[model samples]
Target: MSMPPVKKIVTWLLVIFLLYAIFTSPSDAANIVGSAWDVIANGVANIGRFFDSLIARS
Candidate 1:
């Protein structure tokens, strides 16, 4: 009934859901992680290019 207990219940529910997803559809989880990593890699590459352009200008 209180806020803290409610939050804990929701958190546990999400953990269960994630565990179910991971066990039930591992390939889909792998794809999701791969796509996320790709996005992060591309962002870092773009930042490196921006710094390189800045250095070239100076």
Candidate 2:
């Protein structure tokens, strides 16, 4: 009912779900992580480009 308890419950649920996923379809989980990494890398690269442009202008 409280926020802290709710957060703990959600975190546990996610951990269980992830464990189930890893046991069932490990390749799928690996793919998901790979895709997530790619998205994060692209975001970082884009931010770097934005800063580079700012520096070039100044």
TM-score top scorer: 2
TM-score, each model?
0.73, 0.89
| Residue 40, model 2: Cα distance from true site in angstroms | 0.1
Residues 1-58, model 2: lDDT tens digits = 4579889999999999999999999999999999999999999999999999999999
Overall local distance difference test of candidate 2: 0.97
**Per-residue C-alpha lDDT of model 1 across residues 1-58, encoded as one tens digit per residue:** 5579889899999999999999999999999989999999999999999999999999
- Give the C-alpha miss distance for residue 13 in model 2, angstroms: 0.8
Model 2 superposed RMSD (Cα)? 2.4
Alpha-carbon runs more than 4 Å astray in model 2 = 1-3
